[model samples]
Target: MSRTLNLGILAHVDAGKTSLTERLLHTAGVIDELGSVDAGNTQTDSLALERQRGITIKSAVASFVVDDVVVNLIDTPGHPDFIAEVERVLDVLDGAVLVVSAVEGVQAQTRVLMRTLRRLEIPTVVFVNKMDRRGADGQRVARDVVEKLETDAPIYFGSAITGVGVDDLVAGVTSSLPSIDPVDGPLAGTVFKVERGRAGEKVALVRLFSGTVRVRDRVKIGDSAGKVTAIAVFEGGAAPRRATARAGQIAKLWGLDVRIGDTIGVAHRDRVRHFAPPTLETVVESHDRVALHAALEQLAEQDPLINLRLDGDDIVVSLYGEVQKEVLETTLALEYGVAVTFRETRTVRVERPQGVGEAVRFIGENPYAATIGLRVEPGPAVFRLEVELGSLPRAFFTATEEAVRGTLRADRVHDCTVTMTHSGYSSPVSVAGDFRGLAPIVLREALRRAGTATCEPMHRFRLEIPADVLTAVLAALSKVGGVPLTTTATVLEGFVPAARVHELRRRLPSLTRGEGVLESEFDHYA
Candidate 1:
């Protein structure tokens, strides 16, 4: 029997994720006629808002056969706001086709997405799409993928427009794809994404990591020990007759009361691998109060990474990036039958008072009190502090770590950069979560307030424009807070400028006139 591979097409918004989906479908002969994302006729992005906005708002799945292997393709939204959608979909994918624009190599959102993929350990291939577009360079993009994104991914050249490199990409996907081996001793699969199906039934799209599953098989999910009584295969839009599924197979199973990070499977009854959850949440503003909840719920159903919650009068949905706010508005108005407005998304941040000596008291009847004196200060943005006590008992250390992590999560400290160093240690354990729940309500909000000290996305922007536009282009950078870190000019040939920053928002597009191209990575924040 031929094996099936589940893959996702991921990129920054307008990086041709949907366009690549259209081309891949066409190449696989799933569609007789090709549809354009701009025109909104693509099979994956059939939603009306997707067509009108010419961008993918939710992750859409479509399947095709290539090299006798069934490839289940998930086209995910590239905008940061919909990052929750990407995060949820990545749970189901065994591999990904990371589409980077030839003119714009690795971008800000791309860097964040790549980090998430690495965390998940999902194998990936880089596709440099829009190669036929003016100034397109596949080699440059491939270099950016390796250097900036730190991905050892090989580039498969392809123009989704003219089918220039589509065949090679398809071949690489089929032949070079890596296999995800099942866990050593148990049946393990992760609940990457969850959605509400027809008539309020919850459907979980699970990627089994190992072992076999049969019809009527009983499986436990997450710590809640939610069980699934029925295992059903997904056949296009309908349920399949098959009663069993195996490792590497994507199955739609019912009876799983799953959240985005939950893991579900047999054998691994007590242990669950929790995927990263969304860090930001926002309310959906709509004129119809009743419809707002339903629309947000439907959107949440489509993308579980968007954790939707009703906190009293507020309807909150988790988000991954800022651009998602706009996408949410568009998706609500288009797909959910509600015209909506969005409150400016509040970014979760972390705050720690400087020079404050704080102590956490851990006292048990066992007469074990561990206290450590500490001072709080900012650390690097990405690394977290982890303490392993060799002298302490394993259970004590575990309990302390759990307590700290719990405090941090409840306090939303993960939203900011944290560094923990050893201060002097005493008998009483002073291990408690610190620096919780910061906020950045608008631009220019202090990086400290945002719980994120500014870390600018760096890009080696390759622009191919008329030579006459060079002066206007260079000047536009200053207006957008971009410093021309490096510029190489050639007469009549245009310019290739490389810029570095801690952040780029609204300025990159404004400087480029939506015509000049750019791509960037998260270079370390200075």
Candidate 2:
């Protein structure tokens, strides 16, 4: 039996997460000497931009042995812009190490990370980093953990730079993480990361949760299946050929065309979920238009949650915050050698039909020479097309259905995908040679007439402040279009427009004289 743990290290920006990773690998003898994030030579912050900025932009993977256990570590970026990166990692994580700064204490991102970890029910251990800093206080940080994060888990103090308290932290991880019980079932795993090799062959990093997989095993992903040309176990950011990987192991595989969040083995049982949608979007432009599109297309393959798409002639990229925007800009210039400009940013919005509606495109009027009728109604899921098995000519069925689903998935009115639970179509006349081309037009018209209610992304926020500043905070919230649902002497809870969230966050500290605490999460699109 192989003893492996898929552990993820998470922290706020500048919290010394990558430093801790370096220290861990060094202590385990995986690396001889420590590399500094400041020097851009750290083992995990592999990209040039990450090294130059001294901040991790993408999640990195490495392997080290700890007390006879093989730990595959994933170091996640601390900036909120790359949160989607963190969310994807959570899908494959067996346990997580939450690195909190001893000097800064529990910051906003720390609170958000804790909420997500608890919500996902992933067992966690808190590591208080930077104990040697000028203002570092382990006890104070621990207290902040309890008061701000509301977690009672065991805490370990460590400095990623000086290597103090690292041994104890590793020991705590070895003792605290729950061992995964291998199930006797067919092979199952989730593809958490995708990359393009130098030869342009697709590579993926997968976390197998059950059964066993081998180098030549045939794997199924969605409707696509391919033989595994190669398999390698990750070691200190490198992969060495491994004949087989069993349950609870993370492996890098080749010769597979799969995207992030895709499942392997029994699809229903192993499908990965839970990704926060992007809240903002910006139009990307470059001097060489074709190069810009090509670059974005490749990047979209790496991180699908970015939802890179073309709106009219503008290529729009979804983003989390300003930090993400900066990283994307830097990556294009540094990695792809294409300097690009982004238009003014806007909050992404979605919409749902207010009521049922229908539209018809007459056979003679339309260029396709086909009469297509569609009934659009509201529902929870994205699209469900109910067409009589033989309603259309045999050849046009697949194309027609694809058109319907494709149109439904496009940005209709609010730049959000229009979801329809039930849409039915029946055309009695037999149409030949792709007459279904007009179906999308009819569906798009129907959706427009159906009426839509715009929904802006909203954040549910909790604020703790001095009782004396209650009135001032209330006024600030109102000025920012915040609606409080509940309020007490020191605590406030309410929904605020995500676009205005940054404004409120900036004002809270000054309003409370750096004593106010604010924690927020995406509640819904309201």
For model 2, what is the C-alpha lDDT against the true structure? 0.81
lDDT score for candidate 1 against the true structure: 0.61
Top model by lDDT, which number? 2
lDDT over C-alpha atoms for residue 368 of model 1: 32
By summed lDDT, the worst window of 10 consecutive residues in model 2 runs over: 415-424
Off by over 4 Å in 1: 111-121, 138-152, 180-185, 226-241, 266-323, 330-340, 344-347, 351-526
Q: Considering every candidate listed, which one attains the maximal TM-score?
A: 2
lDDT of 2 by residue, 151-233 (tens): 98789997999999999999989889875655668888988899877888888988888888888889888778988988887
Give the distance in Å from residue 81's predicted Cα in candidate 2 to where it truly belongs: 0.6
* Model 2 residue 250 CA deviation in Å: 1.5
Question: Which runs in model 2 stand beyond 4 Å of their true positions?
Answer: 181-184, 268-275, 385-387, 393-398, 412-436
